[model samples]
Structure formats: C-alpha cells, structure tokens
Target: MSSTLQDLVNRAVFYSTEVQTHFGALIADAEWEVDFSSDPHLTFTPADGAVLRTRPHLLGSESDREKTWLWGWENVNDFPDAIVGLSHEVRKFGAAEEVSELTTPELSLDEELALRLTLAAKEATHKWAHYPAAAGAGTTVWLLVDAAEIALPAPQVKVSVRALMQGLTQTTVTDHRAAIESYVAKRGIPTAELPEGGLRMLFADGSADLSFDDQRRISNCDLNAPLEGEAAEQFAAAAESTGTPAEAATASRTSGSASAPAAEETAAPAVPTPSAPAPTPTDEPSRTEPQPVEEPAAEAIPVAEPKPDEPAAEAADASHEQKQPENEQPRADESVQPAEAATPAEEEPAEEAKPKKKGLFSKLFGR
Candidate 1:
C-alpha cells in the first residue's frame, strides 16, 4: 500500500516522544523568550538563574482564529533565513517523499495537525527536540530546536516504553505495530520476530514483548523485568495521568478539525515522565540576563491566499539566498527588531551580512 501522512506520523511519534520527554526535563520550570534578528536564538531562564540557549528553526505556526497552519517557508512574517531555513528542507523532503502536507504552504487546522507535522519533521530532519511557543493572538509557533544540553543519552527500556505509552495519549495513532517497529529501527535497538506474531525488543537492561491484534493495534506490552525506583514511579504516573489508546482514538473521532491548544499544551506536560533528573545550577553555563526585546503588536494570522507560481530556477535562487550561516554567534547586546512589512523583493542584503554556509537541515539530514 502507498504511504500516507498518517503512516509517516506513526513511524515518527515514538522517537519524537522520547526525545521530547528528555527536552522537557532540561527546561522544566524555565521561562522562554525568542529573538528574531541578525542572530536569532531562544533563551531559557530557570528559577536557578542559569541561562540555556538553543538555535530554533521555525517549523510552522498554528492560528486559533484562522484555524489554519502556515509553514515557515511561506515567509508570511518575512522572518530571516536563520530562523526558517530548516522549514525549507522539510518541504524538500516532503516533495521527495510525496507527503503533500509537508509540501503544502497552508493547511486547515486540526486538533493534532501541528503535532503530527512536527513529528514528521522530526523523522525527516532528524532534529528530535521541539517547542510550541505561544506567539500572541491565539497563535502557537511550533519550533524545532538544537542544543548540546537537550541531546538524549543511551536508550533505556523503561524510558522508551514510558514515552511510547505517553505518545499514544498525545495524538492519534492508527498502527501501533508500525509505530513500535519504526521507533526500534530509528533507535537502532536489537529485536526479533516471535513465531506467534509477537515481537521482542532487547534492551541493555531488559526486554519487552509486544503483541498486536489482527488490526495491527498493540494488544499487550510485557517487559521482562519490572522497573524500579524513579522509573517505575514515572511510568505509573504517566499511565494514571493520560487516557488509554482506545480512549484517545475515540476522542480523535469526535473532535472536529478545529484549532485547539490542548494537543500542543498537553503533549509536553501530560506525562511527568522526565527521562533524567533536572540539572544542577553548578552544571549550567554562567551568563547574563537576556536583554528584553519589544514584542510585536498582535494581528490576525495571515491567510494563505493563492499566489502565482514562479519559475523553478527563480524559486531555487530565492531559497539559496535565504539560507543563513549556521555558525554565526549571537551578540549579547543585540535586541530584536520587529519583522519588516516589506516583501522579499523589496528587502536588500546588508553589506555586513555573513556568508551563507550549509543549511541547518542539510547538515543534520545530509540532503
């Protein structure tokens, strides 16, 4: 059978969930601020006053009023290439894979579309961490982030399984067997197919036996060894906090495709399943407070009206011009200016503009 967007989503959700859980723990109790300027970055300040910085790629934005999603590559806000270059790579991957959702500039919003697209992006771009920033006026901007601090350690059986369970509650998954298979292959975990149609995954610490029903839905998940200490506690807590896969499926059916923040809001915090303990203050890099930047005035989400098509070479040239240098360092004193209203045709390059290097997605995905 030909692959659908849902199939891509199923293959990505498990690994995405595991990495997102690790990311949440790192930024727990932290305040975030984004600056889109010559040097774009997202700063996080925890209660302990340590500064954690990450380079953010604008994946897309969801508007509650418009009930639509706008891909970053659409350039609606006239954001710099530094902030949106990765999104272009996503579009290219989508075009190559024949996934229409990734290639489409605008889409009607659904309860889970933003999260699903983010998961698909994770699979394609191999950037495992993402953040849903509330960009005022009922819009949530979904960003895929990169930083050394958010990297995942070696995979653990308990942690992976907890993420799997948590992922089922967060979004709709049609094929649990495929989800598990994709996750294992992505993570490079050893596995074997059982004679009775079950699959056994071998982890360093233990093993898990997964059985699927005739519909390819997961029926039973049995771990060879019981979890201990905090792992067991986190697993139990996640189970109690979220509904079962059956319940999630029912909700997906009844909930119409209206823009809702519940999926974005609940996905990160739903499971208290932190993959690791919070970092100590001493371990963080010492840094000054991030300078305050002026917030842009609230406006209605930009509607994705049809546009005349440009020549393929012209479009490729425009994309090349927008690709920003990945190694440009942020200046501490720099303040974010509001995005200009001028069209891309009207904007001129600065004399001091840094030379472009490989796009972020190109480096990560090697495309």
Candidate 2:
C-alpha cells in the first residue's frame, strides 16, 4: 500500500518543479522499512539510504550530465493509526483584463503556489480523502495543524519572447523551451529551471493533491473549489483597483442610450440628401435628349443611300452607251473614258456600304 501510494503520487507529480524539489529533499532523506510479526524487529535505515540517482542525460564518453534523484521514506508497520488527520483551506485570487491584454507579472510564484495549494486542499477534503481505502482502514480524520508556503519565481526573468510568440502563432506544441523563452521575454519575467527530464507538476493543499505532466499545463484544475471563487473576486477587485471606468460601449449600443454619437454621424448625411434630390432630375432630362439624337445618327449613317448607287451607276452607264457608236466606244473608251463613268467605279463601295447595317459584321470588317 505504501508503495502503491508512492507510485501514484510519483506518477502524478513526477514532472512538477516544486514537487521535484520536495521529492529531491525526500529522496535525499528517505528510509523504507517492513516489520513482520514473525521477527518483530525495527530496523534503522539511513536517511539518504533509499534514494535513486543517475545521470539524466546521455552524452559522449567525456561528457558530464546532470543527476536526478528519487527519494521516499516508507514504513509499513508504523502507520499513524491512533488518529487519522485531514484538513482543507482555499486561498483564491482573480484578475481580469481586456481580451487583447497580455499576461502580466502580477502573480508571484508564491501566489501561484498558494492557489495550487488552496485548490489541492479543497479537493483533498471534498473529493478524495473520503474515498474508500484499498487498505480497508476506516476512520474519520481532522486537521490538527496545517501550513502552506509559497515561493514565487522572481521578476525580470529573461526569456525568448519571439520564439514563444512564433510558437503560439504557429500552434507548435513541441518546442516548449522556445515558447518558455518567448514567454519570459514577453512577460519580462525571470527564467526559471524548466522541466528537463520526465518531471511533471503537482499541487496539494492541507487536504488534497493534484498533478500534471511535464508540459507545465494544468490538469484537474478545480474552478468550482471555493478557493477559485475567492480568486475570481480578487480578480474583480484588481480590475476595480485600476479605477478605470467599466466599458459600457456594448451596453450603450444594446440599449440605444448612447446613440447620440452615431446619430450625429447619420444626421450630417441627412441634410445633404434633400438638397441632392432637386438637381438629380434636372440633370437627367438633358442627358436623355442628347443620347436619343446621337443613337439615331449613328444608326442611320450606314443604312441610308450608299448601297443604291450600285444599281444607279449601272443604269446611267447603260444610257451613256446607248448614245455612243460601237466602234467609238471600243476606240475612244480605251483612250478617254468619261470621267463621270470612271468616278462611279471608285464610288461603288459607298453604294455597297448602304447594305452594311443589314450585316452588323459588314461595317466592322469594312465590307
């Protein structure tokens, strides 16, 4: 049962930085023992006896890597059975900003830790502590004493702000180191040790506990915990502390109470419209008269009298030939044809042009 509990916690909080520190201290001072009825013996194990340590990074032969430690102290026989104890407390604070606002350095590591502990405590008391035990031990416990301490990471932390922004924009979840660096830059906060190995997160209050993986993302956040309500109130108070007027723009629009400004914009355009109506109709009549005359002129030019000249020229030439001798026509026509008759050959195209309107394409192709 002890091993099982330890394993469960280890799985839960293995990646947490604070939890890592706590576990490190624990591993460095841990002791494990088993007392059987057969032997009835209590063995003294060294405080640092049960710790496991190893090089967490792989490097070449000459390279040195950081060491990781897992520590625990366990005793199967010395369970605190006379009276079990449980307690809970929630400390909550909340803040709000515009959706466009950036994360601020308002929260100290200690404050965040307090929030976590508060959440953890509430969970311990209301959710987990009363759970049926695997060991079959049954008893009610009360908190005789409890304390929660918070240590916040310092300000002015250097981080890769650009990397964080880019990663966020690109939705790249894998490069958290870059994102963390970017987060530091953007928030102007100090860079703390990141989760380098398989470490995850853990939270515990006087009563309960919660944990998450190494992503530094929260798991099992209990917003319904009373602590969270206080947090929300704190956030509201923080916003009020700024003394900035609450934004009423949306409400103003909804209720039409503040429509005077919009009305001013709309009212200016109204004055011009009545004046505009008078000139619009007057200008329209002049435009229509010019357009009708121009349309007919353009249409009549091609279809009028040009094509009838082809037949008229043939008739005039036949009359001219009737007045000339056949021999003179053969001889004098070859040398001195009448200019009027010669001119009609050049003018025949003008005659053919009269039929052009019947073929829309004839005018375009110069037929």
Using lDDT, give the best candidate's number.
Answer: 1
lDDT of 2 by residue, 1-367 (tens): 1112122122222112211121112222222211212222112133434332211100000000111100001111122221111210111111121211011211222211221222223222221110000010111011111111111121110111111111122111333433233333322222112233311111110001112235543222111222234333433343355553223211122111122222110100000000001112232110000000011110111111122321110000000011123332211111111111000112355547633111101100001
Q: lDDT for every model? A: 0.54, 0.18
TM-score, every prediction: 0.62, 0.16
Model 2 worst lDDT run, 10 consecutive residues:
267-276
RMSD of 1: 18.3
Candidate 2 lDDT score at position 2: 19
How many clashes in candidate 1? Answer: 0
Off by over 4 Å in 2: 1-16, 33-86, 90-119, 122-367
TM-score of 2: 0.16
